[model samples]
Target: MLDIMAIISDGIGGGLKSVLNIAIIVFPLMIIMEIAKDLNILDKISDFCKPLTKWMGVSKESAFPLTIGLVFGLAYGAGIIIQSAKEGNLDKRSLILVSIFLVCCHAVIEDTLIFVAVGANGFFLLTIRLLTALVLTILISKKLPSLDKEK
Candidate 1:
């Protein structure tokens, strides 16, 4: 028979561990994002990414969130994308493009690190993810207008 006290202890321990892990990752990332914003470095980075975004039919405004999703992860980047959408910065086409890309390959850095720790080929995985997302986003961008008309 299972011990009730032991199960309770394990549950609480798991919850605390999860909370700590999230805090460790999120707090430092938030600080870095804030510093980048304060120095206008994010704008510069987004400017450099404009050509790639344009190729995927994504807006310049969406580049910031896309870059964030690429580096940090979807959870952190999503807030920026949602706020921009609410502010009328991203049209349906741009939103669709960004969604396709991020869904395929968000959290490149963190995911690579985690995979590498487990002996996976992080660089190879990262490259594959990026290429796949790029190709798929390009295809989606090309097809989106026709799809929209059908809807």
Candidate 2:
């Protein structure tokens, strides 16, 4: 029937619109991230995260990816994390800790802003996410066996 065909068409069109909307946001964010990396802005942000990395007992190499994940989200940060791992900058323990922390609180700024737009309390949401990530990372770090022995 014509109604069935119309429904199918509408579904496909709606799906494409959703994908396009996400691409619009993601593409610009990725470009900006590349620009920041080239300009060494990412290094400065990583430096700022050193204390947090130390508190979590992960290596200094994890700071950059951790910062990226917090600011940009895991989808973007995963590239940096993978590169660092391939370069031997991150050990197993560091990778696990970074993954744990990021999983808990990736994309704080973007997520908070989106929620705030929908009438959610941004500060409270940000605080809870950050705290949860910190506490969970630290606790998990303590539980993971030392990588030194794996060698």
Candidate 3:
């Protein structure tokens, strides 16, 4: 009976504990995203990607998604592509190429640092990941037909 009561209590309001938990998770994320937006950090990220995207055989417009992958990793970076794809910003050909790149790997900065901390062979892993992704991107481009017929 006591356990049931406590579970019910937690399910209902849970008072300050719930509020504190929400604040702890949300506040920092909101603040960081706000600062990032104001600082035009995404723009800087895109700028750094311009040359790489071209070399990848994708368009200049592709810099945005690739840069996102470089900083944030596959999920968030691929989310960008999906969102943009839905909004019709990206053609299917480029989307596939970017998707292939991200699917093989995205080098998250903090994760790489953690890899280094464990005394792993950092550059070896990084090199293999990048090479695999590059190869997959090209293979997908060669074999698959473009989905975006609009532009």
Q: Could you tell which candidate, 2 or 3, scores higher by lDDT?
A: 2
Q: Tell me each candidate's TM-score.
A: 0.70, 0.74, 0.64
Query: Could you tell me the lDDT of residue 125 within candidate 3?
Result: 73
Each prediction's RMSD to truth: 4.8, 4.2, 7.6
Q: Which one wins by lDDT: 1 or 2?
A: 2
Tens digits of lDDT, candidate 1, 1-151: 3799889999999889766766676677668867876898867877777888988977678888888787668886788788888998977778778977998889786677556655689789989998999999998888778434465
lDDT of 3: 0.73
**Cα error, candidate 1, residue 140 (Å):** 0.8
The local lDDT score (0 to 100) that residue 59 gets in candidate 1 is 68
lDDT of 2 at 44: 90
- Candidate 3's TM-score: 0.64
Write model 3 residue lDDT over 27-138, tens digit each, in one string.
6655776687689897997898776676566767778888788666788888889898898887778887887787777845545545654566778878777778777777
Cα distance off (Å), candidate 3, residue 10 = 35
Number of clashes recorded per candidate: 0, 0, 0
Looking at model 2, the pairs that clash are none
Question: For model 1, which pairs clash?
Answer: none
Best by TM-score: 2
